[model samples]
Target: MSGSGTFAFTVHPRGRLREDLARAWRPLGLVPEAVYDAALRRLPLPPVTMATAQIGGERVGDVVLVPFGARHLLADVVGGRRRVGQAVDRAVALGADVVGLGALTATVTAGGMTLGERTDIGVTNGNAFTAAIVEDQIRLLLDRTAGGGSRPHIAIVGASGSVGSAVTRLLARDPAGARLTLIARTAPRLDALAADVADSVEVAVAHTIDAVADADLVVLLTASADTLLGPQHLAPGAVVLDATQPRNTSPDLRVQRPDVLIVDGGIVSVPSLRLRGGDIGLPDGRSYACFAETAILALTGHRGHFSLGNPTLERIDEIRARARELSHLGFRAAEPTSFGAPIALESRSAVIA
Candidate 1:
């Protein structure tokens, strides 16, 4: 898997919030040139670099650094389909057997469909693999914290989004008998999603934070523009999967809730990749699920969109099988980390309680 093969490319934009807001406001008449100038004066320039990895004897590459810094830029680039096409072309030129879109890239690309149409190489959004990892993490947390006694009540925030809906459906089918809560800004959409899973579990809709007040486990996959869950909102001994890229978890939680466990959803480990950097937020040797999906597909020689749409139970199983078959060459979620601190399973109970 090492000598000149398929490369996985992860595209990342670098900048702080003020810079992003200034860029957005520049196009509008909202802010004056002086304001933009002042903001830039105070902003520290951050360089965006492409994070590449070689997996399964093949080189997996990621294309980081877009011109714009906000989610809107991400959405626009992949929204029209033409830009996603261009992005895919760039990946293929870099020797990618399959390209995986991360976060907003995947969301706006329409589940890799548009990108696939534009690129000769395979394209995948990697949601199926993400679902698998999220579920695995939830189970691990429950086992460590709850002693596997009773299924923890779980809440899927942003349940109307593509990833959130899929996660809700998957959790509903689990035999753990965990109570499930579906949260979204759109009440109707939440209700519909809940109805879809009605047969599997008792599902309810939550349009506000109060709905998730009693939740023991929370999976946040929302595309919301602002942070939804904060330290005050969560109960003690809670486990949260911050699936959103910029993150939906509040910064205050780091100092506020030492008892709750927070794990980034996309982190996974892939074989044959030697990462020199000590750790980039994730535990050492682990890659994001989106990153791993591209490598996994390259390893198994799958060159198509493996996961898309509001993922269903059936689709989840299919991806799990594919991941399992390539288990020798797959990625696992990074261990739980709190406020940028690593949490060991043995010590998790004491820290949370």
Candidate 2:
């Protein structure tokens, strides 16, 4: 544990992504801000190092927040990369041994590979740990609902993406016998992924969301700016892991469909923290798994770009092993979170009953 060096994490104004961030602005409508964001996107802006925090205790390290917003990052890729790369350079200049890319900053840059190539410090999208935790929480949900009885039909949206592909590979390796359907916009990528996991589990491919509507368990990983899955697209008692940052399931579904279990995937427990609860969209003692991944790398001294494009099954397993080790040291996954808190299991049961 010699590598307790400072690290920086890139974040953007999540925009209308979460209800907490969109509250008062929600009444004003997303268009005005989106339009303003579009205007801001045109300006050449450098990544701002917004805040610095000292994470104390056994695994002490400093964490810096680098500014980038989903709206701006998605609107202009070339400009966004320039800004993010600038942020990384700043972190490196400021003595950060590693930097973690969050939200669109992690995804749009080829999962941190291209960005890492530009920096001497370590780079990671932090998707490996994310994929592991998502898969674990999905199994826990299934155990609670399905009770290990029958094999469930699982569908993964954005199956061709890094996190989706890793989740698909992990789930396929499970002996639970769940059938998988990979959904993505590209047919060739889906076919290739399905073929890769052909020996592990029963697999199929689809280029549309409709094919996954009937699935008992759905994992949403699409990088779409807007929500994709709605109440009409899921079956009763369906469990959804909305792994996408902006959330793949529309906010309306939380009220419209109490019968469904929608978990904000990739949340993990953090021991020491000095941030307001509402600021980060997480309750006390919890953080995003991607953030935790950076902490893990910094604490464990694993350097270089990690969990980049097309992360192999072996790499995912290796990260999962590290997570297990962290769990022993008091770092672990938090309770399944939905609508900004631990999901209401009683309500879920009432709907199921």
Candidate 3:
């Protein structure tokens, strides 16, 4: 494939209320929430074009709406799979070299693995670059918390996930040596991931978020829509990297805890790419690493399915290497953002203590 390769990333409404606000549904405000929910599913909103961008001939991408919410898909996984497959096929029809899955679409499709197996066109969950960014943020946090020559304890809430597992491997291979607490719902998957890194670094597995209570650094990557982290689960001066869709960090944590810092996961600085139309849910010059992954793959001339299923270290490193070779493209983790703005570290109470 050439550098002019085209990519498309998929998205869905997070919830009915969010969609109502996005479409300015004041006229429909009187309608009951359950009515709106059923109407959305039965109506099957068509694929809407959310955003489109092209940076000369280096890269081209279109973000299209999948019109499905996490709850909708999770409720009917079989139908959700069909919807995802159909959506990718339509994207391929629109000249997409690779189709990227976003939101709950990835979780429902098993990290785009199912679609990759069914479609000839390339498919990606964009986990490779997302994993790289997570590791980069974790490294920065570790450096900030460096003290006493005491090895940092890293707890990953979704250690069995694509992004989590990739970073788990990357961190374990680091010579500085950090103890890892792998927390996830499934014991088998957690054990498997732990075994991969247990020899390289001390590893522990936990099935609850409480396991993070004493961790120096915690990474959240679960698909859970609920806030699982609370005040009791946080350690003083700990760093929380929240990379989940619905956000696993409790809102109360912000109101009550002043010593725990957060580095928003998945957001990356993309200073060069210019958008002429549509909003990508980011301020100018910033985007989610998953969306950036497909764009980078296009720029790097990768023409096959990438970042499907669980990610590997080799894939993460490869994507990062390819990204660096592009001129004027600076891809790195962005600072923690609150309410659409990046917050200064010194200004945050989490860093004061």
Best by TM-score: 3
C-alpha local distance difference test of each model? 0.63, 0.72, 0.76
Local lDDT at 217 for model 3: 81
lDDT of 3 by residue, 110-135 (tens): 99877766556788898999988888
Error of 3 at 43 (Å): 2.6
Q: Evaluate model 2: give its lDDT.
A: 0.72
TM-score of each: 0.79, 0.87, 0.89
Candidate 3 clash pair list: none
The full ranking of all candidates by lDDT, starting with the best, is: 3, 2, 1
Superposition error at 168 for model 3 (Å): 0.8
- Residue-pair clashes per candidate, as listed? 25, 1, 0
What is candidate 2's TM-score against the reference? 0.87
Q: Give each prediction's root-mean-square deviation over alpha carbons.
A: 6.1, 3.8, 3.1
